[model samples]
Target: MLARSIIFLLLSLSACPLFAQQKYIMTVRGKVKADAIGRTLAHEHIVTNFIGAATVVDVPGDDSVVIAKILPQLLRLKGQGINTLIECTPNFIGRNPALLKKLSELSDLNIVTNTGLYSAVDKKYLPPYAFTENAAGIASRWEAEWTNGIGGTGIRPGFIKLGAGSSALDSIEAKMLAAAILLSRKSLLPIAIHSGSGQAAISAFEQLKKSNWKPEKLIWVHAQNGTDEERAMLANEGVWISLDGVSEKSWEQYAGMILFLKKRNMLHRLLISHDDGWAVLENGSYNKLDLFENGNSIPYSTLFTKLLPALKKAGVTESEIDMILRNNTGDCFSF
Candidate 1:
């Protein structure tokens, strides 16, 4: 009887969800403990091919030139104390896990990639099959990337990324959201959606509620585009408010938004970043990289050089800043 009681107690503890799960975030290199991702810029892009999915061609060969152009910026970011960067360029829009992995190795920074389709800009970035495939089918593709690895590179995605074009979720966007929810449920990865507007963020949140998905799993990327009321409402609903797109011009506005949320005790729900990246300009016979005209003269340094100082001037404590840059980011991306 004593042996049986001990065996049952052990089995019960093993079956508990808390004991059964281990928390970690997937990086281009591999998985790391959640606490290890220090001072993460929650959203940024390495390189984006805006040539659209139909005309975009993967120019095979060494990515030396592209790496040459972008590597210095990443190294500088590492110098600025940013330990991890969440690369937000979705698959068709130049989601290169292999390239990200190479950059990560070269710079010694934790770079994360995503596994989902971008359906924004009138579905220009989406592939042909995205239209014909159902939600389950689309989800299966993303889930396979999470389980196995992206495109056989053996590097997995850390989260799900979806793009919405407007306030009303169009058919393709709705389908993509459904697929994201499905994949998130299966893989335990957070879903970050590029909301085109405030209503779009609300719409996505409502849909998640209808699907019975946890609001904490949904990140409203580009939440800076939304109003304070909208941001407050969604933050109250447990959605991760990603106030990305910080730049030299926008740091003050971002600081104000952060303080507003801080006043409401919603600082823990915020994620901040510079939506800074390079746009691949493909000519007839050559490709060139153009710094995104997002108002940051520098690539990834404004958050440290400009915004944080402004927040500090406004009396935002270091621990509160850490909550946004370190704790919130790790929690949002960790599975």
Candidate 2:
């Protein structure tokens, strides 16, 4: 009788799911596959710091205070038919388990958070934990968030994120990338990279591939900022390209990039996002806008309300748009 009881307990423990607290049999292991049929914004920041970047802006306040002020703005986004938000802030300003759970409870939108490092440009501002921490150290932190919970909630991050700036890649970045790649392979998680400039995407990809990462599980964001050759090479490598920076007046660079890629019939592997999250005050109040607007506020609806149609009118097929905006994102970020 004792032996039988022990065996039953062991079996029950083994059968318990990884993210058992989330009420799902399987943890979100790889690209999430879903209908994603409604109006979905591929990339948008529900909450991030305007001053978190290395460069300081006029916005004066504590980081926590700034983040606190941004909650209502995200709520506004939910009302705009934006069903999803991929909050790609790096670990220092990201992986807020309590904040994410709060947002999830507040809105019907799906808020998929990330865990990883930022570009070399942010090296100056990175917390001591990430810099002093080794690859295993970082991985352990990430695993804690995944298995246990983030910021005291059982809400684990839905994906991983990496960033590259104008400067060349560094050892720290490489180490973070390697760690994220290894964790991704072990856990079958999807990764999102910020290729703002330089050969960061290619460099990160080289590292991930070296670690035998599945190309399908990789998402190289800000591809709209890369050159045509770079974009084509990445597409041919079977990585998903995110063109979420499209803006008519502001992001002409990305606009041209997307149009060119579409012309080359390389739009299927693409995922569209606006990457917007800025608070701009209008008459006696404020509003939120795109990330790259340079203080010029463009409503968050510009993507679905404007840029997507422009892509269609510019000879980009409806099928391609649908795949990028809805299909590819859901598929790549699913486990």
Candidate 3:
């Protein structure tokens, strides 16, 4: 009887899922459990060279120049208890997986990068080949990156980064969004779309719904660009509303936005970030994006440094703060 009981116990233990507690968020190096990701800074650009190399804005075309400029800023983020940064530079702009891997190693931060293409206002940023690819074709490309790692770097993307016009998605943007929806349905990875405007989010959600994708998987990046009513609409539908671009100049505005979600009891769906970072190489150039020169106070540390306290002072509880800064992002990026 003892032997039989031992055998049954062993079988039951073997059948149980290991790593059940670790829901992974893909980074430049590899995957880290969503909870392990620690105080995350969602929606940032580690390397961004999307606009034409207009030889003017002191674009550090060299890797060394990029690294020298940004590592200190990242070190500051680490000092402030931030462990993970969601680098949102997409393809055709400045998404470099390898450099991101290097930065992760150097900074000891879990850096989650993304797959998917950016939309061209007039097909400007998109490569010529993008015009030829249909939604499925484009989706296949992104899916392969998610499955097999991006561009032979062995670094997989954690989420899909998509963009659109403020009012509506253009033809190419629509096709790419469709492709993203297809991939999201297949893989169950989260999709972060730059909500250029309220109409863009509505239109994209409509199409995604037709495809039978869950609204929970969609993230409205730059959601603050829309009005309160528009944001409420998206937040009500169970999508993520990212109010990332906060500075001392705008923390109150974001606090108000948080309050907006709180009143609706949908604060868990909110994601906060700086949406700003230093970049070079037109993507992950390792150059820090310093929006805080000459008394501009939009540093990456605002979430921990300023915003959290303000949120608390504005009547947000500690648990709610954790929900926004940690749990919400962990839940959003996890598969």
Instruction: Name the candidate that leads on TM-score.
Output: 1
TM-score of 2: 0.75
Tens-digit per-residue lDDT, 73-147, candidate 1? 999999988999999999877778888999999999999999998888888999888999999999999999999
Q: Could you tell me the lDDT of residue 12 within candidate 2?
A: 86
Instruction: Give the lowest summed-lDDT range of ten residues in model 3.
Output: 52-61
Higher-lDDT candidate of 1 and 3 = 1
Measured by lDDT, the strongest candidate is 1
lDDT winner between candidates 1 and 2: 1
Measured by C-alpha RMSD in angstroms, how accurate is candidate 2?
A: 7.5
TM accuracy, model 1: 0.94
Instruction: Report, for every candidate in turn, its global Cα lDDT versus the true structure.
Output: 0.91, 0.64, 0.79
Of 2 and 3, which scores higher on lDDT?
3
Report how far residue 309 has shifted in candidate 2, in Å: 1.8
**Candidates sorted by TM-score, best first:** 1, 3, 2
TM-score (C-alpha, index-matched) for candidate 3: 0.86
1-335: candidate 2 lDDT, tens digit per residue: 99999999888877787523321111112223355434456666644444443443332223344345666666677776565677665555423445555555555556677766774566753666777878888888887776665655566777777766754557877877777876787666677877765277787777777778788777878776677888878887888888776554545565567888777777777777777665333211123422445322554656656676666777777778767766666666666
User: Candidate 1 local accuracy as lDDT?
Assistant: 0.91
